[model samples]
Target: MEATSSNFTLSTILKTEDPYSSLMLAVAALVAIFCYFWIQGKAKSKNGPPLPPGPWPLPIVGNLPFLNSDILHTQFQALTQKHGPLMKIHLGSKLAIVVSSPEMAREVLKTHDITFANHDLPEVGKINTYGGEDILWSPYGTHWRRLRKLCVMKMFTTPTLEASYSTRREETRQTVVYMSEMARDGSPVNLGEQIFLSIFNVVTRMMWGATVEGEERTSLGNELKTLISDISDIEGIQNYSDFFPMVKDDDEKAPLSLTHVKSLLMDMVLGDSIVEESHLPKLPYLQAVMKETLRLHPTLPLLVPHRNSETSVVAGYTVPKDSKIFINVWAIHRDPKHWDEPNEFKPERFLENSLDFNGGDFKYLPFGSGRRICAAINMAERLVLFNIASLLHSFDWKAPKGQKFEVEEKFGLVLKLKSPLVAIPVPRLSDPKLYTA
Candidate 1:
């Protein structure tokens, strides 16, 4: 009976030959071949210092769904509780390393500074900044060096800032006048918007020298404001293509798409520009306020993702070549280990400590560290300090009726107040001349 059954099976296999069955066998054989190589590769990688520990990822999307959009920095900080300070997380196909402690930050920003100086520019950043000509996303090379030198020598030097101090004061005085009128009328003002306008005007005047007050200035300011807002929105959006570069979008490749945004400066020589830096000993408190604000809410919370040029070990863990690096300054700033009361808004902390945002101290690198630090640090400092001081010194502020003061931040390319600050400004200055536009 066993011999008869074997003969019948052999005869059936010889008699039946379907095209579908042949194709199925072929596909099965290919799959088996692929699996063999895949398993072999996995076995080989096991011998190396494995990629930093991270939560289990799904098939394709990775750990993106786990991130909270409203507060991405806080979500990342929460992850550190499970996976140590230097942990790995996948955003789509991309590998990302989150550095949350001062030690890890020092390694990436100071020790291995040259290795991680290259930026991982987003599609929007490349499109908006004229093919990455601007200093923000430019690669580390001779061109970048030239741009940095020009910025330091021509624009942000102490003499240049000092030359333009009068322009800042003039704009601040105008803002005071406008706020005083609003105070007299008992109307609530959008404090954040007002502050933005003041800073924008000061920076523009410093860059473009003098301009007549008319529809031209208003039109230019409004246009620049809209462009800036749009750029910010594009920058902060979670575009999957940024992580998975194989994906393409029509708009990103389109011509005449935000190619020449007039306000973005790299090494463009503007002969008429005038801002000369000077000693600011009297404004020590003003500087502290800006520093405190930055610590609480860095403009770029994840400090412009960096790219490792070669395979490197960071914090005793193997960081593969071309891995994305996110130095979570936001998380580091709020660490209880480094700060006394991490959540509090105490500007006095800066006054007590000698920590400056010049990238010297890893514990508080709001601007960043080493060679790729922000090129416009001096100008940014002056603009922020002047704006804050002018507003605070000119008026006493209170929340609008029926509104309570709250500190909330929204995730974006630049940190912004979740709720635009709406407050009533009460003029404190006695001299009527001080309020003139």
Candidate 2:
């Protein structure tokens, strides 16, 4: 009887242990399920303010599938219709806030400027711009400030730009002579090619103190053209990694690798070349031309993407921290509200009105606004204006046979003529003595 009682006690202990084990397993299962749902809820929360609106996105991919690789601007504009000017979009998992209206832009660029001073450089942009070392691509920080000071005080100051005027005048004279010869020969000149060469020569000389000549010049010019063309090409748009940081995919890493390769190439070609210090006067006409070109064809129509430093409200919408922001300078420049016949190519508009391209004025922001504006503005403006004025003063331009001057634009980092600015050139109708004098 005692043996039987002991056996019953052992059986009872085994039964009790089974229930405890089962209970632990059930608890673990419940916790796992809760975690899965909790993670999903956190992701959904990142979609931004619900009332502001945006395109519907797919799981993981987001709205990336619907984006047009060629013309991002068109897609952005379409979103504005459904979501209003302050619309949110998901490129992969990343959240971007597109600002299309002037009022909204003014709020972000002017009223709350300091809060939006940081720029986000994409992988592709980082590669072509010397790992964001170039003035145009640098982010907002101490490095950016130091670089800006260098460009302004040393590279593009009025005195430095003016010193290069004689070189510009000489190049202009050559352009006129070449065109005059072409006109005399009755040969059709590719005006686009001519203009590009003239600008290339002027910029190269000023930057490096060297003139390209012979086969080397031709090859170098072609290489520069290819680099610029590649930068503008839309085929390289989708960078999955930029938007989805948590997903460790190989495709996302490809752009970063490509950027490294480009940096190496740029360093080999244009890195060591530096500008020397010299006393000179500033050329006002040249400065004007550069500003005008940038106005018409900004390197990045939207400029560098800026992220909000803190959660803030803009245009009646709550923008969370780390949200990608884009400013549509293209639409702003063409806005009928700010400009007269905004589509017209009128450089004289500046002379006729008090409008300026500096970030101080919200109406014309080719270099961008606030602390994140391009550091190379001063230098770029001087280079562009000097080249444009020299070409125009030296040569009279005409369209090719039966080809009218159509101002159709092609989008890129820099806006270029869709068909290339090819034209016939004639020498400026001026006396030789006057030109020499």
Candidate 3:
């Protein structure tokens, strides 16, 4: 270019400016040349594995300005509708990929399971969990594995669940009795609060029941529940710092029918007694209902959000290192390809099928899949199934007058019904003494 352009002669530059101008010109020329080559290099990258296609991001904010945190999972599913199974999304300066298909889910969760195994800890997570060192947000390595191992040994095995059966049974029976009393008065019960309290007691007892006793346990339990509730709300909030971490600037369940309500209610509780843990396996229908419920409404729809520790290829696309990974269990669960009449509450799909809570079949992950799957799945299954069976067995539910039953969901740190359920329990058991027994 210097040889071809007569107007850009060295003599002209020397004649026009001060001596310092020549040096300035030289520096500018070098920068221009460097930029030309850099552009060429970036252009060449397009020929290689491309990033999963997604909505076009704005200059610096990326897609941060577009997201609505209140309805996050639904928003993600909508984005996937246009971007295909594997969708790339940019939040602030960070990159995130949403996996919406079971095939894509398998690629990230199974084929490259270890690659995207690290939890993408939020700002609150680090603060609450002491710099995210706890098992929930810890990286996939020896330390985290050790913590998980300890938890498994302490509270998350079949043997441990069996040992704690009495506590679960006791708590569950008390709930039935409470409902029965409510039934006698024809008082409406908030089943949500009831189930949560019962589960909370079961969890608290299993976690530290042996350590704390009497009033101290009660006090601690109450405090723990409040703190947990607060923590969940805090964790759900969208923080500006989290979106633009490099930029310092500021600103910015249940229940039964005559014998099978929703397929979830079963015959296990038909006798004059509360459902027992021993009866769980004997009742395949109860298990199917559990599976169906989870499929329709996953506890954590996005599965706690994974992050790739290293650059990886997922579904033939370049998923860069440090990319936040979201396995959209909600969408995948309702995929028409895998499930027939996916929207319907059909438990029979799981009856003859071999799918279990182990996360083997990627198509139905109620408790998630891969190494980061819920550590206490055994305990959870045992607790939930037994409680649900017992509830359905003990009484029949009747929604208050003029209140329509709805399944609308409101996602948060956990998924919940948009409107809390208010239903009255009508005793279904043959013997009235069984309510207290």
Candidate 4:
């Protein structure tokens, strides 16, 4: 086991009478990678609560070689089921803890809320989010608090949201009119596309006011969405540097390139009563529908990931400082212990309960919890509720002929429909003016 420099020489290790120089260099790299992990394992803390149990790691690569990043949320759910709620998995040199149960989630997000306040900043996230200085990824400190306050007080305050009421109503009106046109033409519309555009317009109008309008504004929104989708696609790819930042990544064409991997580890309903923002309070069933949809499909399934600022113990397991933490809200939302008939889509069940996006309930945190809860909850609720109600009240949806309706999802960065929804909207409103702005 002792060192033998002669054994690693180009001629000796390559075992070729005339070994190519690049081949010799590649062989040398393999030996170095082996040594790096060996030293890292030995250098880790020996005294601490033992790390949570997980699948056995393989040499230098760790548990990463076993993960399928495309289905990482579901994959983590499966792993946590077998390894317990708090499971530790090594992604290269990076130690990550995945929490899938409500008890463990509370311990991480509530009990040790401050310690786990920061997100595990991925490389793609850094570039897209101004080197991770944005509110979502900024470190837990006064600066982040200021940003949050600015968002809550100045930006998303009730009065401010109320001020933008007309803008929201106008956008929803446009969507209603467009859908009405589709109904008149007997055409099937892509619900996802139309809704995204409406939401996009609402957001832009709120930000830029009515200064930008018509095709230019729509073009801007389309461009922005395309840009975001590109970023999401890039984030979905598992980059080796993210896992092993210690090792500099060579170009993809290199003999030992570790980059640009295709696979990597990383909802709505409607109803009708009044169908306006002011009417949302009285329409408990509509609210329940939104809650149930969120439960089944939490936007950021892992809640942007939490990184422990210091060594901590949660549920009798050690979570080392700076380790990546993932609370699988998707799994917790569907846990049978907390939710009866969790997998089934039952909006009525929510009608009996008081769970909501306020982030109080650990088992159903669609918008996360504690200080890190989403900044624009007020705006989001208004936009979502109003739009859903408007869509349902104004249109009687019909599936494309001979096609079975199904809701399948593909998870990464954010949850996405596996296939786009195609439905025809038959007008169901009493008066045509209700559909106008």
lDDT of 1 by residue, 1-437 (tens): 99978677645644568877667767987787667645643653465666677676543566887877778788878898789899888787777888899989999988898999888777777777898887877888899899989988898898887788888778766667777877888998876666667777777677776543444444555566668877887866766687787895822221111112112221122212221223244545556666777888788898888988987877767777778888888999999999998877676677898998688889898888988898788878777655655566566777677886565777876777666667798866566666677
Q: How many backbone clashes does candidate 1 have?
A: 11
Which should have the higher lDDT, number 1 or number 3? 3
How do the predictions measure up, each by TM-score?
Answer: 0.80, 0.70, 0.82, 0.83
The sequence of per-residue lDDT tens digits that candidate 3 reaches over residues 1-437 is: 76768678678877875869978988997787667644643563465677788887665577888988768888888888888999988787688889998889889889998998999888877778898999888999999999999988877777888788888888888778778877989998777666666778888788778433334433554566557667876776657667788754400033222345424435423456657787777788878777888898888888888999888877688888888888889998988889899877777788878998888888888788899988888888887887777877777777788785666778877777777767899997687778883
lDDT of 1 at 304: 85
Select the stronger candidate by lDDT from 1 and 2.
1
Candidate 4 lDDT tens digits, 102-213: 8888898899999999988787776777888989889999999999988999989989999989888888888887787778889998776667778877887788855334
Worst-scoring 10-residue span by lDDT in model 3: 249-258
Ranking by lDDT: 3, 4, 1, 2
- List model 2 lDDT by residue over 270-296, tens digit each: 233211112112333333434555565
RMSD of 3: 8.5
Off by over 4 Å in 1: 1-48, 210-226, 249-280
Candidate 3, 425: how far from true, in Å?
1.4
Candidate 4 clash pair list: 69-264
For each of the candidates, give the backbone clash count: 11, 8, 1, 1
The true-structure Cα RMSD of candidate 1 reads 10.9
For candidate 3, list the clashing residue pairs, or say none. Answer: 257-261
Question: Considering every candidate listed, which one attains the maximal lDDT?
Answer: 3
Q: What are the runs in model 2 whose C-alpha is more than 4 Å off?
A: 1-51, 129-131, 190-193, 214-219, 232-236, 248-299, 344-352, 430-437
Q: In candidate 2, which residue pairs clash?
A: 162-281, 162-282, 191-423, 192-422, 286-385, 286-386, 290-385, 299-413
How does residue 242 of candidate 1 score in lDDT?
Answer: 76
